[model samples]
Target: MTDLTGLTIAEARDGLAKKEFTATELTTSYIKAIDSADELNAFITKTPEKALEMAAASDARLSKGEGGALEGIPLGIKDLYCTKGVGAYACSHILDGFKPEYESTVTQNLWDAGAVMLGKLNMDEFAMGSANETSYFGPVKNPWRAKGESVDRVPGGSSGGSAAAVAARLCAAATASDTGGSIRQPAAFTGTVGIKPTYGRCSRWGMVAFASSLDQAGPIARTVRDAAIMLKSMASVDAKDTTSVNLPVPDYEAALTGNIKGMKIGIPKEYRVDGMPEEVEANWQQGINWLKEAGAEIVEISLPMTKYALPAYYIVAPAEASSNLARYDGVKYGLRVNGDDIIDMYEKTRAAGFGSEVKRRILIGTYVLSAGYYDAYYLRAQKIRTLIKQDFDKAFETVDTILTPATPSAAFELNKVVTDPVEMYLNDIFTVTVNMAGLPGITVPAGQNDKGLPLGLQLIGKAFDEETLFRTAGVLEQAAGIMDAPAKWW
Candidate 1:
């Protein structure tokens, strides 16, 4: 039989429907593929036994012609999401051996739709870093390497493992979240499609919190259609999450009609940051040409508040993160260290549990939210966030969606910028604005950089308008052609 591991979710679904292959066979293929690709370090935990069990159940459902939308499809769950009886540590040492008794709403939805679990994918600790390097599990290696270079490139993060696993065909697609560009940036680096739906599009109940206001869950897949399919199953309103929107989740896959006739696409002038690589700029222009050719009227628009987005995001996200992560003080669960007293124990546990990057953000957050600094830092950042939303709101009034580069550059070597936190944070320059504004955004693989590394173009849509993003991204994906899989060295 053809390599079952290489089939997209759509193809596998059709094949399973026709009884071309049993779900267990497909699951077995992925299990073997993942076993062979260990060098990528994408999965922090492997659940082959559980996966086969799930796939066997899916096979039963399929045989009865009662399978759900994602029946028999295998997916990699990000470690941040809780899976009952499975480790869900968010790739942080602090949450060592944390196997939640409950499942995350997102993963539960996927299973409800018949999706099979491949295992937990790695991510940055608490989803705090721009690159995967900060993960206690170690950085995820991007499958794509620069031309003639031996250095392993980062897959991008904190959704790095999700992107890499999809790119490497370890799973059909994977669940990923974005807070300041975690999903889209890594998708760009690994030549996959990732979407950060409008804030509250997916329930955040069981996903480990980083920034409550900014974190949104979505999918990273090999194709835009696969992403659309995954998002349909992953998104739902939950009473457990008060922030989840009550609007009906549309058929995102059906939105990809590949027809964008007369749609107005906005080109934000502010996204043209200084010192951007020429290839990224060229790819942006190329996307513009493609959209124009597809009958989209390209309009140059200004989001003046864009300049403040990164700084404002840093303030607001860390502030919320500081508050959210305080629950992990070693008193309840996970890693704990005994101390002279309660205060000493709290100090020692946190000091030993948190990584440097997580500590840095927590410190920044605490500093910003402190008594004197609240108004000057956190409050001001919140105001800037409002202005940034207003900027996007104003632009959306004229254009159906806005376009930008997914990242400042393609994947860089691991540890290249780990030394400079500012440089590391800059990786999210093109992505944080969407989070601040609570808008839906997607990144589609567009072209390869000079180093032969993949680059992606981003499309941002109005609040709760992921349909437009999927539609526009379909057009771009078609125009760009299929990206070639990286030459496997592992």
Candidate 2:
């Protein structure tokens, strides 16, 4: 029998249906893989006992010839999603020992579809950093290494662990969230597929609040089809979350026709950022050529508001972060440090709980939302955000979807970029605009750099039009033919 740990979600699904492998066997294989993969620091929590229990239930259902869409599939949940009875910290000390009484709407939806939980994956502290280095649990190492280089590269952030786990085949797929480039950038770094559906596509009910307006939940998987399958189970309308769109979810897997004939793909002029690595540019051109050959008409389009996206995002995200994070004061749950007074306790708890990057963003958020600066900073940034969305609205009128480099460069060695905060933030340059516009964006591994590290191409799609992304990404995935796994060095 093939290694159960090595199967993709789609492959595992078919295998389980054929009765070639029991869910217990599959679950045990993943448990062993995760137990041995601690060096990668991808998982923050492990639920081996719970996983086996769920797997047993799935096997009974499969034996009865009845199973849900994700029956018997094991998946990693990003720490941000609150799993009832499971520690759901956002990789921050502030939420220490905090377990939700109810499961997150997204995770609950996955569970309803019969997906077994492997464990909680690590992520940025409060989902604030671009590199996984900012995670309180420590950085997640990218499974991919540069050619002959011993230095450990980061798997990208805030959803770094989700990407690393999928790339390492630790899980068939994992749930991930995108506030800025959290989902796509990490997928680009780890040679995995990640999609951030349009804002409101997935219910945000139990997802730990980051920037309320920008946070969205999605999936990271080894292949586009697997991601599509996961998304189908993960997205739903929820009465608990007013932001969740009440639209019928599509069968995203069926949409992967691997045909993009006559599809209009736009290449945004502004995405050609200055100082983009040569390898990134070449990979992008290669993607364009592949799509062109497959019959997608490449059109040049302009989104001049791209330059202001980062600045506006920094402002708006932090402002919301300031407001949403205020709930973490020592009053309710989590860590609490005793101080001389209530005010002293509040200051002490936050200071002790939040990491440096989290503190930095909170300060920025507070400053921007302060009485005197609200009009000059927060309001203006909101106005710019509207303009950024308008830019996409205009482009989509002429083009079906937009194509760009997922990141400026391939994954870099961890800690190398963290010293300069701005440099670290720059990693999201090509990705943040999609979040700002509240549009769907996906990262598909396209090619490898000269260093042998993976690089991906970004596909920006119309709102609620993920089928087009799956179709186009499937075409690119076939053209690239990159299904090799990283060498097992860990």
Candidate 3:
């Protein structure tokens, strides 16, 4: 038989329906692939036994002609999402030995649609860092290496493992979350497709909290169609999460009609920052040309508030994080350290449990939310966030969607930016505006940089308008052609 591990989710679904192969056989192929790709460090835990059992059940369902949309498909769950009887550490030492009795609403929806779980993928601690280096489980290496060089690069973060596993074909696709640019940035670096839907599109009840107002869950997959398929199953309204929107989830896959005749595409002039790499600018122009050729009218627009997005995001995200993370005290279910009394215990446990990056964000968060600085920092940041949303709201009046580069540059070597936190924060320059405005955004691999590393172009849609993103991304993906899997060295 052909290599089952190489098939896309759509192809595998069709093959399973025709009885070309059993789900167990497909699951076994992925199990063997993961076993051999250990050098990438994409997974924190492996669940081969559970995966085989689930695939067996899917095979039974397929035989009875009663399978769901994603029946018999294998996937990697990010460690931030809780899985019953499975470790969900968010790749942080603080959550050591903590496993939830209930599953995250997102993962539960996937399972309900017949998707099989491969295991938990790695990520940055508390999803706090731009690169994956801050993870207590260690950094996830990018599967793609620069031309004629062997230095392992970062796959981007805090969804690095999800992007790496998908690029390496360890799983058909992986669940990933974005706060500030976690999903889209990593997907760009790894030559994959990732989407961050409108805020509250996916329930966050069981996903570990990190900057509650900004965090949104999505998927990283090899193709745009696969991403559309996964998002359909992963998105739903939940009674447990009050923030989840009650709108119906449309058939995202069907939205990819590959016809964008007379659509207006916006090019934000503010996105062309100083000192940007020539290749990134060229790729942006290339995306514009492609869209123009596909009958999209390219119009340059201004989002004046773009300059303030990053700084405002830093203030607002960390403030909310400081409040949400306070629940991880010593008296809770995670790591604990005994001390002289409750206060000492709390201090000792937090000091020992949290990593440097997490602690840094927590400190920034606490300072912004403190008594004297609340108005100067957090409140002002909220006002800036409102203005940013207004900027998008104004732009959408003339354009159906906006397009830009996914990252400032392609994947850099691990530890390259770890020393300067400001440099690290700049990685999300092109992505945070979407989060602040609560709009949907997607990144599609568009071209390769000079180093032969993959680069992606981003498309931002109106609130709850992921359908337009998929439709336009389908054209971009078709024009760019298929990105070959990185040469495997792991």
Candidate 4:
């Protein structure tokens, strides 16, 4: 055996069932890799003991001919999702000691499918920042290394650790959440494939709230096929989450027949932002050209409300985050920087526990939802959100999918734009719209930059149309193929 590090979860399961490798061996290898790759700081908590136990159970199930899609496959879960009896920090200091009594719906679904957890991956505290530098534990390092570049670039945010781990072969695949650009940005940065399904597709029952309206959980993996398999296990309706719709989950994997001979893909004009790198634009055009060559009709479409998406998302998401994160008071089961009075205690705890970016978001959120500003900010954002969704709804009327740049550029060096909050916010421009409209989107490694860093292209689909998204992405992915670069391509 060459080693199980690079295999996908589905491939690993098949191998495990065939007795090609034992789960114990595979999980142990990941534990070793996690330890060895300490420079990345990708994981907040690496749990080899839990992984071994889960692997043992999976092997038992396989012996009984009951192995699931992820039987014994190790996954690095993003810290935002709540895990039972284990630390589920949202990468925030305030939630330092907070352990959920129940598992998040997404986590539970993966667990029920027999996925072995490697550990909790790091993220921006409460998914607030773009760079992984905002994490309380430390910033996650991009596994890629470009020649002549001595500095380590960020792996991308919120799900940065997940992408870096998978890229570094620390785990086969990892579970990630996408509120803004979290999953896709990190995946792009680390040269992995990540999909963000339509909002409400995956149950958010126990996911530690970031931005309630936009928060969604998805899978980050090395290949689109693997992503499709994991996504299938993730999408389910849970009664516990009121936002979850009662729609039948699609057979996403089956949709990957590798045939897109008669699909209509829309190219949104609004995505051509000013000052975008020529290479990124070229990558997007190449992706479109490739898909067109695969027999898909390419149509240029206009999404007029696109510019409003970022601004609207900023208002609505932060507003909801302020409300959702308010529970982390001193009375709750988390860290508390004590003070003399109750209000003082609350203020001190929040001021001490939260990072600067988190506090900034909270302040912005509070102001948007505060007295007399609701109509101008929150209400207006809601209207724009509807318009964004409507634009997609209308576009889908003429096309099966949409094509755009996942980000304006490739991954940045650590702390390159962290000091400029506005610059960091611009990174989410291409991604936040999908969340606002509650549509499924995906990021695939399209091409590399001049310096050999991975450049990602995005595919957007209709509501509950993850099947189309995955199938289309799979077709495009087959055309794009793997990004094989030297270790120095970072």
Evaluated with lDDT, which candidate comes out highest?
A: 3
Q: How close is candidate 3 to the true structure, as a TM-score?
A: 0.99
Each model's lDDT: 0.94, 0.93, 0.95, 0.87
> What is the C-alpha RMSD, rounded to one decimal, of candidate 1?
0.8
Model 3 lDDT per residue over 1-490, tens place: 9999899999999999999999999999999999999999998899999999999999999999999999999999999999999999999877899989999999999999999999999999999887788899999999999999999999999999999999999999999999999999999999999999999999999999998899999999999999999999999999999999999999999999999999999999999999999999999999999999999999999999999999999999988888988998868688999999999999999999999989999999999999999999999999999999999999999999999999999999986745679889999999999999999999999989889999999999999999999999999999999799999898
Per-prediction TM-score: 0.99, 0.99, 0.99, 0.98
Candidate 2 vs candidate 4: which has greater lDDT? Answer: 2
Q: How accurate is candidate 1 locally (lDDT)?
A: 0.94
- With a 3 Å backbone cut-off (N, CA, C), the pairs that clash in candidate 1 are none
Please give, for residues 1-490, the per-residue lDDT of candidate 2 as tens digits.
8889889888899999999999999999999999999999999999999999999999999999889999999999999999999999999999999999999999999988989999999999989988888888999999999888888999999999999999998998999999999999999999999999999999999999999999999999999999999999999999999989999999999998877889899999888888988899899999999999999899999999999999999999999998999999978999999999999999999999999989999999999999999999999999999999999999999999999999999999876845568888899999999999899999999989888899999999999999999888899999998568898889
RMSD for each of the candidates = 0.8, 0.8, 0.7, 1.4
Which pairs of residues have clashing backbones in candidate 2? none
**Which pairs clash inside model 3?**
none
Better of 1 and 4 by lDDT: 1
lDDT of 1 by residue, 1-490 (tens): 9999889999999999999999999999999999999999999999999999999999999988999999999999999999999999999888997889999999999999999999999999999887788899888899999999989989999999999999999999999999999999999999999999999999999999999999999999999999999999999999999999999999999999999999999999988989999999999999999999999999999999999999999999999999999998888889898999999999999999999999999999999999999999999999999999999889989999998999999888876845568888899999999999999999999989888999999999999989999999999999999787788998
Worst window of 10 by summed lDDT in candidate 4? 481-490
